[model samples]
Target: MGERRDTQLDALRAVAVSLVLYAHFLAPGGTSFLGHLGVRLFFVLSGFLITRLLLEARDAAAFEAGPALRSFYVRRAIRIFPPYFAVLGLVWFTDLEQSRSSLTWHALYLSNFWYALRNDWTPWVLCHLWSLSIEEQFYVAWPVIMLLAPRKRIEAITIGAIAFSLAYRFYWPITAVPALARDLLPPASMDALACGGLLAVRRARGADVPRWMRRGWPAFAAAFLAVVWS
Candidate 1:
């Protein structure tokens, strides 16, 4: 059976995209934070949807990891790669010099690393690919962790991931790591993904959010403040 549509999540996606569009196109200066929030929302949404699908698949398959893993990779590749390569092809045919020069990294799904290593966002045309690269990296590893881990351990694993991401984000800044790399590295950004995954796992287990979090606005406000603090 096909998954049910989620209108709330659809609204969130629309809002996130609008935030990014407005940040990049409509807003003047000092609005990069909006763009960051939009991208973080996208990361969370992707994590939630993908983990939910995997959990559903696992249950349907009676926890058969092989089939679930195969189905995920195949579907992910089909849905992600074609349009990605098509975009690259357009860039190539149009002779976009900067994007074309970096096309190899994007094609290999290493654009994030390439940008982080350089500590720059040159080839501005392809700068956005860094987030896509992080998503692809997460896609590669998350299914294995989600599908293969013991059912009871899923929450713990997700929590550990969130902790690890937070630790990395916190620890990197105090060290010599370049700012771009600190922010763009996969580990540093996994908290949002893991937070989303945690929500999916809890939902799949038929668990409701804690009572303290049940009121939506308060939780949202707290999260917004936490993001600002971090």
Candidate 2:
């Protein structure tokens, strides 16, 4: 366990979780600027590390997606699905706030798709869980894509995904801004994850991105700060 530990990552996780708690609980209007920053940090870090791991798995001359596919789905299922349902059920059934006609749909991570289909921002019952929904959606699709996607294709997808996300934000400034403003969801939120994945691949090829990011921490902090503060 100790061997697996990355001190900087551990520190960041601690900070991120703490900020999430503080942002949700203490931040005014059920949100906080600092708290929001915490989550962004997490997304970036998750991208960075998860991609790195994927690249490592790709190497070892072991690009076979079998192990990655099985391990990831299983771990994600155990860690996310059960607890998510448990919590969603608890909140809805107990009427923690209010009852609703439908919830299982959201529990299934179809909220965004539904939101795209219909539009129910109310019943903010498990609003926070939406991020997890996006993540689950990512797990369901990304790994399969990652497993099959050629190295160049994966990189292009990552770049394109990020670009489209940003374009949505820029074009639909009103819509994208709010999502980005929200702690959980940003307009091109998944791009950061993809970016991390890209970074991971670069690392696999012995092309260093981590060192650049670390040394350019000032730039990263500035760019992130602009987005958060804006």
Best by TM-score: 1
The residue-by-residue lDDT of candidate 2 on 24-75, one tens digit each, is 7777883567766776667667777756655556654655688777876776
Score each candidate by Cα lDDT.
0.84, 0.65
| Cα lDDT tens digits for candidate 1, 90-161 | 988886755777888989999888889888888777888888999999999999998888889999999899
- Model 1's alpha-carbon lDDT is 0.84
lDDT computed for candidate 2:
0.65
lDDT of 2 at 215: 97
The alpha-carbon deviation from the true structure for residue 126 of candidate 1, after best TM-score superposition, in angstroms, is 0.9
Candidate 2 stretches with Cα past 4 Å from truth are 1-4, 60-63, 111-121, 174-187, 210-220
Residue clash pairs of candidate 2: none
Could you estimate the TM-score for every candidate? 0.90, 0.77
